[model samples]
Target: MSETNSAMTLGKRSLMGLVLGLAAGGALYFVPECWLRDDFLINTVFKIVGNGYLNLLKMTIAPFVFASLVMGISSATDVRQVGRIGIKILAIYFVTTTIATTFGILGGLILKPGAGLSLGTFELSGQYEAVESSFADVMLGFIPTNIVASFAEGDMIHIVIFAVFVGVAMSLLGTQAEAVKRFNEDFANVMLKIVNMVISTTPFGVFALMATTVANLGFGIIYTLAKYCVCEIFLFFLFGFCVCGGIFTLLARENFFRFLTQFIRKVAMIPFSTSSSNATIPYSIQFCRSIGVSNKVASFTIPLGATVNMDGTAIMQGMTAVFVAQLYGIDMTWVQILTIVIAATMGSIGSPGMPGVVMATLVVVLSSVGFPLEVIGLIVSIDKFPDMFKTVLNVMGDSVCTTIVAKSEGEFDREVFYGRKAAQ
Candidate 1:
């Protein structure tokens, strides 16, 4: 009861934060040019608050993920059991991803979102230094040459690789690695606490972020890019109903609508509102636990889902790649379609769980097919709103994947899933 109340309080605070931020942004947007157009007072204050919060968030991701991942892996399963669970997880990921991208490809062709926008090309302001990473490079990149350097640079995939080895070593070392595992687990808990503290200031951060957005580009950009929302929504639900409802719920023999409404929709609102997967992890774990996932399984799968599973973002990539192509008047070829599937899949894996992360990942996909960087410029301006939905889908996908894995491992409780025990 106390825990539930705490969650309610937290949710209320976050909702208040969103409302306050939106109000401030609206006020800033409506200000007269002569009075406050270029005035740095409001802009300057919010920028510092907002950007500082963002930087603080950026600082936490690599370390938090590193600590939690190592702890989760070390504690979750025995070394021999890792292969069975790992293969199943990976297989589910690939299969569902195929469904996602297929939905994207067919949706892009049929729906033709962003088809007739007479928008000018805007240059994407990021350096995509053309470096061809072959399959060999990708395979080799997993093994960090210098573990210290990987940590310093915050290279997550590399960190994930390194953490796995450490975890395996810990498992082998048994008592020798006990202290280290405890330290990591403690460190992870501390990081999560810090994240909640940081998130408490999200109102101000969101205020400045939205304010900066509207001040520079104006809401007209949102209007212009509205079609992208249509595309994303279409794909989000299409995937949601079919893949989530069909593949996960139905196959599991759980009531489809009940699973969507009862389990997912409740917690999914967090990521949708906050647009941060890491922030949503606590709620996600709670929901999964309430549904009867074992603590170890929930702990491991939730963090791993944040790190690797990105069904939501992948769907966006498929559609966005096509949208960019349409903006440039380029008809996508079959070869390019295949390339997009590959790039989108890989990009989803590499994309971090942060604000504006999908944008960073869109770069990888765009560059893979030789899509003009300038197309990114036009699309980036209106990325904020779309990103919220993208995150909802992303986190929802993670929850689904985690639940499925728990079921396979027999870590899930059917009684809890259907709330039979709770009824007692």
Candidate 2:
């Protein structure tokens, strides 16, 4: 009863935060930047509090993920199980990312959001130049050059590599790994407690984030990006409910509507304000636990998902590529379309963990088929809205993958998942 009440309370608080964000954005949208004054309310008050909340969330992310991953890997019977789990998660991630990109391409080609618009609509600045990175660099970079540096720099992919090595070694050690695994579990719990505490301050953070965004972007930016935003949202829901919810649940033998509403919706809506999967990791893990995912699986999959799973980002790449192509009146060749699918799938795998990492790598996706890079600047002013929704999609995809893997492993508690039995 106590745990149920706590979750309920948290859900209400989260909803209230979202509402406050909407209210703030709507109210502030009417105010001119000159009248609003960025230094006073936007910076000193809103930015400070909002960024403080985000910082607290970031504070836990790397450590919590490290601890969780170590503990999860150590719990596995051997390296084979751990290897299998990693491969499965990555496979799911690849399939979903490819699907997302394909849909994104279709959305762009069909909707033609950028078609018939005058080039004069967007002032193209040839200002930003991307220092290109090869596919080889991305792949070779995954192996940790220095394990300590990976953790210190918060290089998640490398950290994952380093952590897995340590975990495998510990697992092979048997009795020796027991104490270390327990310690990692304890550390993860402490971080989770901190995450809950940080989440308690979300209402204020949401209010700040929304207000600042609207005040800064204003109505002009919204109108310009409205078409793109709509397409992204539609694709996000289509993928979330239909792909992740409908098809996945059917395969897992879980109720689609009931499954989404029962827990996923409660937690999945969070990234609208937070906008960072790193911050949302703990809450996602909490949701997994509530739905009866084993801690071992949740710990491994959630963090790994946050780092590697970029379905939403892949969608952004595909759609935005076509959107840009349309702006320039360039018809994409079939080979280029295939190139986007392949590059985005691989790029999402190697993408960085930082906020706005997608936009950075968007260049790679675009360059594969010779999509204009300068158009990136035009979209920058309006990327926030898409980024928020995409992050939600990214997080949801991760959760879905986690749940599916858990069910397959017999690590899921069905009664608890459906809310028929309370989570322990």
TM-scores of the candidates are 0.60, 0.59
Lowest summed lDDT across 10 adjacent residues in model 2 is found at 122-131
Alpha-carbon RMSD of each model: 7.6, 9.8
Q: Candidate 1's C-alpha lDDT?
A: 0.65
Model 1 residue 131 lDDT score: 44
lDDT of 1 at 152: 82
Task: Highest lDDT: give the candidate number.
Answer: 2
Candidate 1 ranges beyond 4 A from true positions: 1-81, 118-224
Q: Candidate 1's error at 27, in angstroms? A: 21
Query: Quick one: best TM-score, which candidate?
Result: 1
Q: What are the runs in model 2 whose C-alpha is more than 4 Å off?
A: 1-81, 118-224
lDDT of 2: 0.67
